[model samples]
Target: MSLRTVARDDLKNAARSYVVLGVVGVFAALVALVFVSERNIYPDPYRTLFDVSFMTFLVFPLFVAPLSYLAVAGDRESGVVKYVLGLPNSRLSYVLGKFASRASVTLGAVVVALLVGFVVALATFENAPNLGRFATFAGVSALYGVSLTGLFVGVSAATRRRSRAMLGVFGAYFLLVPFWFGFLPIVNIGTVLDAVATTFGTTVTESTRSFVNALSPATAYLYATEPVYSGVTDQYPQLAGTFGGESSRIEAQLWFNVLTMAAWGALGLLAGYASFRRSELG
Candidate 1:
């Protein structure tokens, strides 16, 4: 089997799953809801799109997790991997195929939902939506989804059991998504950094905080695409202050954050493929 064949088969299988259908439905509904409900509140079409992007930033990881976490580990656990490997396909093709298939499913959902939201914004909003900015937001959002799908698919490829893959994927989601920015009270990077700063008799500067926050894929996505949304900084007063009226610094630069997000996806694929290539099928 070729890589395309494997990817095609996987996509077909995923399309048949009720879980996948439910996920796509819920994701589209949420995006549409944001566009409809916030039309009156955020009169400007760009701001409305920004709000939709922010919502996706928070929830896209969860949406992509289940779709990808079972890519390979589930087959391995069920002994189907043996049969798969027995085909003319190499492990590399198998892993890449899984990644491609899952990424396609994810990107497809995002594009459709965003398109629907764009139509809603056009029809209901007073101000006209900027096509260039809207397209840029969609492009950045799609890149973010692919990055996440790669990461989760990597976890699936690296692990041999379904439980391990699920744990690793969601554990990553909690750490990098919600908990990273102190959205949860349990424990967060911000709290830890504060304690470390106090113990070391130092303060966390704006640049330091921004740098740390950018380490999360979600934050990286936002910063990477902030240029498209001109008033993004105004929406986040703290971030505006953090940039200190200038965003030319290395950490604050859009390229750096874009690299950060891209690195996560690239490194994840490399690491997982290395592990998957060496593991015994039996």
Candidate 2:
């Protein structure tokens, strides 16, 4: 079997999973809730879209972590990897196939959730949702989800135990999502930095903070979508910096945010494949 065969089989298996179904359902429901609740408050289509997209950015890693953390680790723990590798499939094919199938699942969920948002907007709002802006948001969301999938899939490929994989991915999720920004005070980097800055009267540069935030896939996703909210509304805050402004810092550029996202996927895949290739299936 080639990568295509593995991917096809994996997709079929994922389709039958209740966890996948639940994640997709929850994601769609959240988007719908945002649309229904915020429609009256934010009448502008772009503002509503920003709210929905921001909500997605915050919760995306939660939805994707479960779908991806067990992609290969579960198979290995269950001894299915031995039988699968006994076929014509190489380790590279297996990893690529898993990535493709999981990425497809993630993208599929994004599409479903966004479609639900669009339909709800059409029904509840006076003006129809802007198709171009909606499509752009959808595209950025898909890229963000897929990038995160690659990271978790890499974790799955590297770990032999399911528990370790789960811990690794979710631990990553907390660190990259909540704790990165001081939602959890004790462990939050941002919070710690703020305390230190306050105590020492040392200030962190905006460029430095921008670079730190750009390190996260979630923040990078926000940075990449900044252009969509450019002229529409000021509701969406800039995560990286001003896009295409006069700033000479690389973090201020739109291309840097886009590249940050692409790099996460590529680096995760390469790192996972390297570790997986060295693993002993026996």
Judged by lDDT, which candidate is best?
1
lDDT of 1 by residue, 164-267 (tens): 99999999888888888679875888889999999999999978886788788788887766667665557654445544456676666877877877888878
- For residue 253, model 2's alpha carbon misses the true position, in angstroms, by 2.6
Q: Let me know the TM-score candidate 2 reaches against the reference structure.
A: 0.90
Writing each residue's lDDT as its tens digit, candidate 2 over 167-272 gives 9899888877787755775677776667788899998777777678777777778767766766654444432233444446666566887777778887887898
Best by TM-score: 1
What TM-score would every model get versus the actual structure? 0.91, 0.90
Residue 240, model 2: lDDT of 22
Where model 2 places Cα greater than 4 Å from the true spot, the runs are 191-203, 234-249
- What residue pairs clash in candidate 1, if any at all? none
In order of listing, the candidates' clash counts read: 0, 0
Where does model 1 exceed 4 Å of error?
195-204, 231-244
